[model samples]
Target: MGFESVSDFLAMGGHGLYVWLSYAIALVVVVLNLIAPLRTKKQIHKEQARRLRREQSQI
Candidate 1:
């Protein structure tokens, strides 16, 4: 609606590259920030579970 055509939308009067790049970077950072914590938590839980199993086997 704001643009006249596909080319116009993509061009954004020559500022499209900067605008799109910023959006892409922001999306990547947001996704990584969201996923990294869950991955870390999973790794920690796995390590602790393995340690517990090893200790139990030793006993």
Candidate 2:
């Protein structure tokens, strides 16, 4: 409502770069936070499977 157009809204009164950059950074952080746990879980599963295989082979 305060902005006259899409461009004006994007401009954000000349603070658009900072605001958008912060938003992008926040998005990246959130995505990484989500991905990291999944990756760690996958890694742990692989390690456990490998360990299980090794123990079974020893029998």
Strongest candidate by TM-score: 2
Residue 33 of model 1 has an lDDT of 100
Per-prediction TM-score to the true structure, in the order listed: 0.87, 0.96
The residue pairs that clash in candidate 1, if any, are none
lDDT of 2 by residue, 1-59 (tens): 49999998998999999989999999999999999999999999999999999999999
Off by over 4 Å in 2: none
For model 1, residues 1-59, the per-residue Cα lDDT tens digits are: 48889999988889999989999999999999999999999999999999999999999
How many residue pairs of model 2 clash at the backbone?
Answer: 0
lDDT score for candidate 2 against the true structure: 0.96
TM-score of candidate 2 relative to the true fold: 0.96
> How far off is residue 13 in model 2, in Å?
0.5
